[model samples]
Target: MSPQVALRKAFSAFPTGVVAVCALVDERPVGMAVNSFTSISLDPPLVAVSVARTSSTWPTLATRGRLGMSVLGSEHEVLCRRLSARAVDRFEDAQWHATDDGAVLIDDAALWLECEVRSTFDGGDHEIVLMEVHEAETFPDVTPLVFHQSQFRELHADR
Candidate 1:
């Protein structure tokens, strides 16, 4: 296998949750899929989501100032896939609400974060977006969508 294939295979074993990083540009929604999200700090309520520099959405979102991060629930695999596509009407047939900061908060998302873009840095093939949370909303019933081995999955705890 090629190095590219091997690299993908290696990382595929690491399960990750799907999230939509959305922002408003000229009153329009611009967002993308990210599995590279993590909590960096609790004291300041900070988070980080990395996006590919090549992603067209990055240019619009990074410059928009304010943004939202929505964690997709298990049944939202279709939404996750929709947002990841190259060119499509992402908001089509999707239900969402707007945040004060101008982020289009998707309905039924596991968690929604209204954040301000704090910083951006080059991360090889991606650009890391470090955001400061200004407000947050979370759901109580939805389970997060997980990605593993290049596929979507759900986990069951053995208790």
Candidate 2:
């Protein structure tokens, strides 16, 4: 197998939670579906998300650092899938609230984080974005949404 194949296989072994980072660009809300998001440092309230260099949304995201990160709930699979597609109106049926900067706070997310870009590192295939968490809040009821092996899956406790 080639490097790409091997990399994909290895990455697939690790499950991750899903999130959508949405921000305002030209007075419009743009959202990117991401799985490569994590908490990097707790002391400084920092988080990170990787974005592909070739992504069409990269240019717009690069122009702004203040963004909203919405952690999807287990019931949000349809919304997640809609945002991942290249189709029109990613937010057509979805309900969202506007932030001060005009980005969206997705309805019914498990958590919503408002952040500012702290720095970025050029990773080979993706740009690693380090964000400073300015503010954050969690929904009253939250069951996490997870992704594994290029498919949506959730965890359950075994007795």
Candidate 3:
């Protein structure tokens, strides 16, 4: 196998939580599904997500004053796929709300964060974005959606 394919397969062995990064652009909801979200620091309330350089949505979202990051719930598998698809109305039937600052948040996500872009760096095929959280909310009972081996999975607690 090619190095790129081998790398992708290797990376898929590690599970990751999916997140919806969204915002209101020109009065419409715009979003993208990302599995590369990570918490960076607490002192400055910072977080980061790696977005592909070829993504058309990122350019538009990057221009927004504020963006909403929604930690997807186990029930959001279909929604996540839709958001990742090309040339489709991602929010066609998704339930969401926009904050006063134009951050569009998914209705039943496990957690929600309103953030502003702090900095960005080059990461080969992707761009690493650092964002400063301005607001946050969590739903303790929600089960987060997990992505692994190219499929969506649910987390389980061991007794």
Candidate 4:
């Protein structure tokens, strides 16, 4: 296998939680499903998600003043795939509500975060977007979606 493909295979061994990094651009919902979402700090309430430089949605979302992050639940496998596709209306059949500031939050997510763009940095082929949380909510009963080996999965209790 090629070195790049080998590296991708290695990376796929690691599991990650899925998140939808979305925003209201021109009063329309726009977003992409990302597995690279992580908390950067607690004191200042910061979070980060990596977006590919070539993503068509990121450029539009970056221009928005605020963004809504939805931590995808196990029930969101189909939604995640729809959001990640190219040239499709991601929210055409999705149920979501928008904040007054134009942040769109998906229904039934494990967590929701209303954020403002704090900063952005170069991360080779991707851009690391740092966001400062202004408000947040969590659904304790929901199970988060997991991505591993390039496939979506659900967590099972240790037996």
- With candidate 2 superimposed using the best TM-score fit, by how many Å does residue 82's alpha carbon deviate from the native? 2.1
Per-candidate clash tally: 0, 0, 0, 0
Using lDDT as the yardstick, the better of models 2 and 4 is 4
CA deviation > 4 Å runs, candidate 4:
none
For residue 98, what is the lDDT in candidate 3? 98
Compared with the true structure, what per-residue lDDT tens digits does model 3 show for residues 1-159?
999999999999999999999999989999999999999999999999999999999999999999999999999998999999999999988999999999999999999999999999999999999999999999989999999999999999998
Tell how far residue 132 is off in model 1, in angstroms.
0.8
Q: Which of the numbered candidates is closest to the native, going by highest lDDT?
A: 3
Instruction: Report every candidate's CA lDDT.
Output: 0.85, 0.85, 0.97, 0.92
lDDT of 2 by residue, 1-159 (tens): 999999998999899989988888778888878999999998899999999887887678667767888998887788888778886787778878768865567888889998888899999989999999988999857877899988898767687
RMSD of each: 1.4, 1.6, 0.6, 0.9
By TM-score, the best candidate is 3
TM-score of every candidate relative to the true structure: 0.93, 0.91, 0.98, 0.96
Model 2 alpha-carbon drift over 4 Å, by segment: 157-159
User: Which tens-of-lDDT digit does each residue in 11-94 have in candidate 1?
Assistant: 999999998888777777777889999989988999998888788887777776568889988888888888999879887777
Q: Which residue pairs in candidate 4 have backbone atoms (N, alpha carbon, C) closer than 3 angstroms, thus clashing?
A: none
The true-versus-predicted C-alpha distance at residue 148 of model 2, in Å, is 0.7
Query: Which residue window of length 10 is worst by lDDT in model 3?
Result: 86-95
